[model samples]
Target: MAKWTTENPAFVDTWFSLFRLGQTKKQFNAADTIKMSELTFFNPLSSKDNLKIEATLIADTIDKVFSSWGAKLENSISRNTAINDMIQILLDEDKTIKDLAEKNDENYFFTNEIKLENES
Candidate 1:
């Protein structure tokens, strides 16, 4: 089983601390920054599975929480571009889609989607 584990206390503390801060702020702050040293241990380029899990969690939250708030988050280009870039980086590292695919017992799939057409 692939799992994400970080031994860095500073990284975990700062992340959740900022998340708590954002939960109370009336205006969104985009100036949040991270230290390079702190980020080095969890580099997406060096940890494909970690990046995939992070991306999936962000996606799941957006789908379950933000989908009903006007526009669905999955329709945003920036979100898709970020995930796509991660997928490309994983491919560059020789990680196949199958390796990242979510498993269902004995089977695995990249994704499952349903598109409804308009009946006019």
Candidate 2:
């Protein structure tokens, strides 16, 4: 099985923490200060089935979070440029997508829609 892990787990946690804070404030204190590396995702895609599991896991997380807070979230992740870029980062790479399509020990994918919905 593949797992989604980040070298900077604290960064990820803090990022989400800010998001929650923004939710309370009705606006992010420093929107422009937030960032994620193009290569933020760290995982070993050992097989297509495993990768699918990872993607599905990501999707499920989003579904659970967004479904609960859909109104507050307003569901803007799909239209986000960062999300699109992350998808591209997954799809544009023949190696990554192919590995994701089947399975490669070294593949990375970032799901923006999957990322946001779960944060709520």
TM-score for all models, in order of appearance = 0.28, 0.29
lDDT tens per residue, model 1, 1-120: 432122322222223323443421211122123322122223545566775665455334433332242322233345455445434433343432222221110121112121112322
- What is the clash tally of candidate 1? 0
Give lDDT tens digits, candidate 2, residues 17-36: 33453311212233222222
Please report how far candidate 2 places residue 46 from its true position, in Å. Answer: 1.4
**What's the lDDT for residue 36 in model 2?**
20
Worst 10 residues of 2 by lDDT: 98-107
- The reply for model 1, stretches above 4 Å from the true place, is 1-27, 30-46, 73-120
Task: Show pairs that collide, candidate 2.
Answer: 45-104, 47-103, 48-102, 48-103, 62-118, 66-117
lDDT of 1: 0.31
Worst 10 residues of 1 by lDDT: 102-111
Per-residue lDDT value at 80 in model 1: 53
Q: Each candidate's lDDT (Cα)?
A: 0.31, 0.32
